[model samples]
Target: MICFMKNNLIVSIQLPLLILFFCSCSLLNADEGKEFISIFDGKTLKGWRKAPKTSYEPWSVNDGVIRGEGKENRLVYLVYSEDENLKNFELKFRYKMVTKGNTGVEVRTRIDKTGKRPFEGYHADLGHVGIGPGVLGAWDFHFGSGTRKEFPCQRGTRLVIDSEGNGKHSPIKDAINITEIKKRDWNDCCIVAKGNFFQLWINDKLSSEFTDHISEGRLESGFIGLQLHDKGMVVKFKDLFLKKL
Candidate 1:
């Protein structure tokens, strides 16, 4: 009986330790298996190009950052065409608004050759407060008919759109506080797109959540771009990373 009790105690201890060891290894493997790829070279615009209709001439790279000085008469875009047709992926980058009017990151976008707007897609909106209502920390939708829907998913809101283009939203209590966004400092932005679900995080806080069931209006694959909204807006982007999910 004494020998059996000793063996039982040993087994109990060993079992817990073994389980812990396997869990640690599993976490390590999951972290190591992430396949994030840096999209920007930080030295030159090797894999990106300016849109054909971009009248602005101030898009440049300096000090390992992509800078856009919006001095154009209209909106312009710097497109990422190296892998234009990305279906579902995760994108992360850091941005700083030097002198903000309005700026945004475009995903699943296509250039409209004969349209007034430069591209058609979903925009992750960012701008200084008082620029406009939908210009800051929201999701804007642009369609081919020049239909722009601003603030479909606002900051601190969770939204769901039905197949017929109907939407419903509610406030998320734990979402990012827009006041925490720095005016003249760098901010982190992360976008995750999987199937019909999309999430946007700013400064590591959930800013917006969206699920699109609208098959007709949804885009499955398209290019990415950085927007220069009108004139007198200055923005910089760095550390652009993408992971195919």
Candidate 2:
């Protein structure tokens, strides 16, 4: 009886440790072993579609790049329609803006057709404000379902978003050099989303990081999109790629 009790204790202890060991190994492999796949063929928009009630189709493939140009009165998106909803992924692309244009990349966002807005989710903003000209690389949430229209975290901020679509920002350590971004020129953007953790980079520089703990408004999985905010601006995107984690 004594020996059986000792064996049972050892087994119970080993089981939890073994589970932890396997979980750590899986996470390490997921970060290092996964390979990126090109979602855009560089020559077409075959796997993407415009959101519903988009007044006009402003996106097209030209010269090996996906281009959007128009004077839209509201938010417009070219959403990736091929994959199942993405839960955790890393996405990268190159983009260029022309003539005071405003644009962004949307991740883990859903189309809200019932409302006036076309999408409901997060946006990684790209463009110049009064501060300067280049990729601001700010983080924002567009709340289509609630009274909150947008929650914005300025450049160089590490933001925390709560369940009610509100945010608080602080200066980030090892922030990216915003000067390195080339205005009106092609620059690389990378976004990593895993669970409620998120990171954004511009031109290989770390831009922003955030943890979303919104129990009520947290988004686990949704579509990917490129945004054209308004009229009289041209935005071009290319080399769109993703790696599922």
Candidate 3:
């Protein structure tokens, strides 16, 4: 009887330890739903480096948000603090469109020495209508490159959308429509990536889920980037968050 009780006590002690260990791991991986680990310091671009500007201009920040206004040529940017990749992770932030040109988030991309651009692995697209969540016809360069044509990103969708296309979104659906997107107002953006499965959301609305065919090379890890096209419009970003899965 004594041996039985002792064995039970031992199990009780070890079981709690095991439970605690697993709980810690779970808490570590809980992405978007948990408190965000700040990527931007909100004061300065301390850990960020600007990409090469085509016109030798600079991107400025306002009231804790960073922005780029292109009056010259297109400027591409990729910033990183350490040598790490952002593969299969959830990223959430708030962005506002002032004047539309060409803007989208780039992920799993490598920065080029030219500083003028970065190669895209995958992108959560916004910049069109009839896209974002599950509206249908979501596309990307990797998957629907030559196959899915009719649907493409057209200026107006403000909804966050999930898509694949060499990190540039295509065949948009459920994305925040440009009309619904408040001009000069702050809006929310969210993205989730797992293996080839990707999901995007804007302003808390489920945008879309996509499967990629090209596979952005399945980079072990890469820097996150914001892009601006030649048209020259103002795009503001703030409240950047990232979590590892």
Best by TM-score: 1
Q: What is candidate 2's CA lDDT for residue 5?
A: 54
Rank by TM-score, highest first: 1, 2, 3
Off by over 4 Å in 2: 1-30, 113-116, 128-135, 147-150, 162-167
TM-score of 3: 0.62
lDDT for model 1, please.
0.74
Off by over 4 Å in 1: 1-34, 113-116, 129-133, 146-151
How does each model score on TM-score? 0.81, 0.79, 0.62
Give, for candidate 1, the lowest lDDT window spanning 10 residues.
21-30
Q: How far in Å is the alpha carbon of 66 misplaced in model 1?
A: 0.7
Whole-model alpha-carbon lDDT for candidate 2: 0.74
The C-alpha lDDT values of all candidates are: 0.74, 0.74, 0.54
* Runs with alpha carbons beyond 4 Å of true place in candidate 3: 1-35, 111-117, 128-180, 213-220
